[model samples]
Target: MTAIEQGTAGGTLNATTARLDRLGDAVIVIAYIISVALYLRIMAQYMVGFFIPGGSPIWEPVIACASVALIIAIGIFRGFTGLDRLDRISLAAVLVLTTVLGAVLLIHDGTLVTSSTLRLPPPPPVGTLDALLILGGLVITVQGFETVRFLGDEYDAVTRVRASRVAQLVATSIYIGFVLVATPVMGLGTAAGPDSTLLNITARIAPWLALPLVISAVLSQFSAAIADTAAARGNLTGLSSWFSGPRPYLISGAAAIAIAATIPTLVLVTIASRAFAAYYAVEAVIAFRTTSGVLRKCGFALLAVLLLAITLFAQPAS
Candidate 1:
């Protein structure tokens, strides 16, 4: 009687776990679709800004056309290696320019201990949903490292794990360094919009920097968009054997165009943040279930709760 009771409880628990895993898988697929759409929208907007000096009359239509072209191009590409190389080159160029600008700013003032120029700004008030959302939106900035998990065909599990760790470390270092270098100029841009803010900031330091900034933006965004598209394709294929060849990419592209037509680019960004937060929350839950140590389980549970809050409450930037 005792053995039968134990077996019945174990079977029930296993059934519950399986159902949860299936739900998590569905959520992840939806998140990946959102990610692909957001990436394409961003890349299209940046490309339009780079090529067209003044804004076009039909802005969203122009973005849609550009996104369609980009989708086609990504479909034609055979692999990520070339795209990765180009992305690295563009990133290196931008880093060099940022470093140079920072060095120039420091040297311009003769007094190293200047009072007004070098002071860090006071921390902004954060006791509100708006502030929390703003900070949560930053999760997008640290996003690309997880792409390794979608590249199973190209890399083994061990290699993907190792690569993801290295990618996260490198990306975090770069983000921190870039922020530090640009701290002085952060407050300089007044009239610049989202797409041109970095360009305007760079122009203030050195007018010649604008050309490289635009080129870097174009290259890096395009590469990143392609990466996201590929990841979405892989995810869809994993989710369903029926999703193969160009079918998944086509569906993603259509969804992206529909989203671009309906949603503002800024709102699209917030939506992406919410999607990624939900995805990560599900992953955290899975991690909590799979891990053995109490500390690890507690940590994952805490992370899942925080991510779920971001998903539910994070708002679009004003």
Candidate 2:
């Protein structure tokens, strides 16, 4: 072939690859949406358990089983269709919601440390076990932002950079603020207890806001689940040419739902958060190694260490 012809062919091949990548990203976004919805539905049932006089039967394992079934069905469908431009838009929407929610909480709390009025005691020593659990949980919680990478194909280089910057700012501001506000409000001692810190914080500020906060929390959790499933499916798509077929995607989605349903809502959330954090830590290390400048490398390293340290040491409010 002539040189110009060869070059033209190469360009076309690259474009095709790029288009496929974008499709995969869209599928991931769809998976995220489904997972998030299921999570919220399950959580809503759990929350109702607290207020209902007899508590609801829907909070049981049976409900979880049903959820899993639904997830699998949805995952399969999304996998079959592949990714698309609309999926990218959905992913962006999720990011925006996450950012806004984080910003709102940070502004509402107005501090980084725990609040005193929430009946919390002093925090445990920095390196103590309880401290580590709290810190670890927070780190895991914040690391959820890495889901962005799964949608890389859906974003152009500039969009990726901007999204990363926005996500980081929002995640950091809210997480740090919560840790600060929660530490004092619930005290180090109470923060180490079993109550949901997010709900507790909202309740303290305004009892009336509690229901709405709980509902929003459910929605957020569901969103995270959907994103998680989408990411998993996307990875699978890359692995198996067969996955490009409809059946495999459906099966994968079903499996995700089944697994989700089997696990307790709280346990699932905790696990998902921790897994995300661990993944983020790895990404941070990779960033550190890849950056050409010493300053950039050091900054990433510092952030990674800080995240790890917090995961290992901070206490959660009771």
Residue 103 in model 1: shift from native, Å? 5.9
Total clashing residue pairs per candidate?
0, 46
lDDT of 2 by residue, 1-318 (tens): 122123434674345434434443444434343344346445556466436634465564455455545544555665413333334545566556545545555554454334433444544456566665754654435544545554545655456557767888976776675565555434422344744455555565446656665555544554555556566666666546776655544655555556555555555444444544444455466556445698998898897787556434444433
- C-alpha RMSD for every candidate: 6.2, 8.3
State candidate 1's TM-score. 0.79
lDDT values for all models: 0.65, 0.52
* Whole-structure CA lDDT of model 2: 0.52
Residue 235 alpha-carbon offset, candidate 2, angstroms:
1.8
Off by over 4 Å in 1: 1-22, 47-57, 76-116, 119-128, 189-196
